[model samples]
Target: MEGRQLQQVLNTQRLKSLQEWMQESSITLTQVNGQRKYGGPPPGWQGPVPGPGCEVFISQIPRDVYEDRLIPLFQSIGTIYEFRLMMNFSGQNRGFAYAKYGDPLTASTAVMTLHHYRLPEGGCLTVRKSTEKRQLRLGDLPTSINQLELLTVLRMLSDGVEEVLLKMAGPKGREVVALVNYSSHYAASMAKKVLAQAFKKHYGISITVKWTSFSKSKHVSETGQEDGTFTPPGLSPLPKPSITPPHLHPKPSLQDVPAHPPLQSFFRAVGSPAGLPRDEMKPQGPVNRDAVSLLQWMCEVNRLGTPRYEVRFHHASSDGFLCFSYEVLIPCFLIPLYGVIQILPGPSVQATKEEVYRAVAELVIQTICKVSNARPF
Candidate 1:
């Protein structure tokens, strides 16, 4: 048992069982948006919401280390108003977390004292003040949205809304964009995550919500960079929009039309024969194909060798959806297609990985259909 415990501590990638973790940690944690929380405002605590400098970001943490060890360690520096450990789906820490103190002074003390502090296991931690931006930029809003109406809707969707300013966007200034300020960084962060889906579901309109740079009221371009990223100079202009080829569209005869083409869910992994849960990351249609069966069919159809998948989780969208970049190497294709797939974030990373495989399989069928359709008789 001692050897097992020691190995668990040493294996940085090991995932701990929830039962084993609960026995070791006393703090009740709630998981959301890929972070594990322990008291954003701890129980029996009453004071103003923590502002800037009240939180410290800690990194280089060992994966096996959980809140039981971390919370107590930071608590030594000062009263911990909150401690959030970024968690992995497989029960390991994401190697970084944030700790909010009761005040700016205590948070500063944590960084001064604990930056580069050596752990008992001989690993060093990097601690610094958390950089939490408290503004969000909303685009694709109704052209007629007034400040009062948008504010009313925002308050209904999320808390900590301080102010809203509408801007005329697009070349003709027909589109409306809004900049929103929040009372606290946490509120802004949470709002950025939920607002996108909230508007779409409740109002049946798609809107983009992302962290904004208050450095300036807006970007030089009227539309501004999307997802909070700036486009550098000398980049090729975005490709002209082209109508999707008819063959690429979901055909009833193929028996493998993809679900959620925008999300690139491809075929969207459906349940297998064993009563497995269907992948409802998005609303999917009837399950006509699984990855394995689809891949086998693709191979037979193309007379190609085995297919290969090279994929990695690249980044998370501003609204908390996970994005993965993938390269599908097919023996028949001279150039393997590279693409990005966006998936709704969830606890199971492995399951998301499997979904990517299914997506690739469905994509292969689409590509072949397009090729076959284009060939001259």
Candidate 2:
């Protein structure tokens, strides 16, 4: 068929161009784990390690497209500190990559200028800020493992192992766990995929890896701030940070959520759905959303699991209304989005909790909308 022949011809041309670039030494190519790293701190590049917000997450890449085209496109915005193209074993991109610019300004420019930019093959790319977490919580190690020995073995097994801190985790602190700090987010992503399996295959030991809810640098003492309030490790006192827990399910269900803990609005009095005043239940502005379905679709598209929330109903304010705040965290997403919502709860505590759930669900749909097109309900 003509289409088959045309595809072959295109592949041939791409292969030829890649070969020429290699021979000319215009780009460096190597394999790290399963990725075909195109240029890391590219050739003749004299620049310090890129700072936070310098990298952008790129998705929906066409499989056949290579760095032969992507690098130059991004270079138009600013200097590319590093670019990594994820690849499949069969010699095509896995349809996503990461690009870190020389500075946050340049990276922001690239996201604005190039997101949804159409490729020659007719697929639009999704580009956004990449999340950076330097530390990974590694669990299920041998009890007798020593810090120095474990550190050395980890350096051999994982790329960019800056250092490892050992602590006891499971079952009365009988298991050894390691907190691994990587030099870059790219390194952590790469290591997360393999550390467990690598440990099993090579060392005959098994382990588990997780993204720590709070980075080591962010962890604080019980008496954290100058204010006398005792801020919990992951959650702030009020109107600030809230602790979120990741789900363990590989494919989480929308209905598979935590028990509904009813919440109340501290500052405003809202009656139950049957008797609550209409003004309190509805927002002043026009609103529309099919939150439950959209959340399920989003989870499917981005490879995320069902979200888990940390809801708290606080003591009543002086105005005689109960207080409430909720934190929603969806597992398996690179982006750690924090959703904020302010809405009147229904009269009873249960109605308020449901209203809060829907509000936060819409917030999630809005937050991820830039990274994903809203599919029709």
Candidate 3:
């Protein structure tokens, strides 16, 4: 086969795989309305395409220079289709602008030819395509729908999302805006299509969607003190930004609790188990070694249909081995077990030899109680 034929075959296979994956996951990708055809699909099968002119998002420009001033600079290279200068509450320029050109080839050429070329001396121009194609400015979100519920709805529509920003957009008692983050441009594009239908029906709230820069929607307030210094909120006096680490940024996961401890520490804590009684030293109790095995099998079998039990797997070691354990004790409610409470009699090998056996015992007890309770899902 010719090289171009082989490439075409490969592209067709890739698109087929993507469509299959979407169908299995219950996502349907349809054509978008008002989608201008500036360029063909990304070197392959026919589908919704992005226009040739890249969305050039600019920032840090003087307010005095409005849309009229920018058009000539941009149109010099290509036919400018749309130009917008964003404004803030005070009717002042937000120091940002967006320009969409008519032709993708011309847009690409312009981006390559005119970047960072100082505009007649001291003036500077920073240009690049916008990362976010479009976003829904969700408002009046029902307070009943918390963060998790909203995220679940979005995940059902897209492949996977990076982050979801929820904030109060109105007065204290009502209204909020959620900035949904998708994994890629295609996923965002797909999400923008499906969200309006899903949201209105489920939440009774209609959101406004627009092609805007995500950076502009991200708001962070740095507080300053009476002493004339800036600080984090709740801190009396602020500190200098220069002293802060360049890599330091507010990440939501910083607040998340890790499920497992380091392997070395875990092993060091479970170094050895208590010596069995003299009679049981032979690795057999009235409940023989086989009984221990049978009891463990039952726990595993019962877990499959158990409603109350929350089962999770973890690794405390570098070796590809898992720690299979269940909690027994109910920390909040110290209710003793009434029925036949069965368990394997020995320390779990998953833990390090130096670990405390009693903690493992406690965990087993907690697991049973929690899993058995008729509680909220």
Best by lDDT: 1
Ranking by lDDT: 1, 2, 3
Winner on TM-score (1 vs 3): 1
Off by over 4 Å in 1: 1-25, 46-48, 170-174, 214-377
Task: Report every candidate's CA lDDT.
Answer: 0.60, 0.59, 0.39
- Considering every candidate listed, which one attains the maximal TM-score? 1
Indicate the TM-score of model 2: 0.50
- Each model's number of backbone clashes? 0, 4, 27
**Per-residue lDDT over 51-77 for candidate 1, one digit per residue giving the tens place of the 0 to 100 score:** 566988888887777776678789999
Of candidates 3 and 2, the better by TM-score = 2
Q: Please write out the lDDT profile of model 2 over residues 207-297, one tens digit for every residue.
A: 7976564333331111111111122232222222212221111221122211221122211221235556543543321112346435644
Note the residue pairs that clash in candidate 2. Answer: 266-322, 266-323, 271-347, 272-347
Q: What is the TM-score of each candidate against the true structure?
A: 0.51, 0.50, 0.28
Worst 10 residues of 1 by lDDT: 240-249
Which pairs clash in the backbone of model 1? none
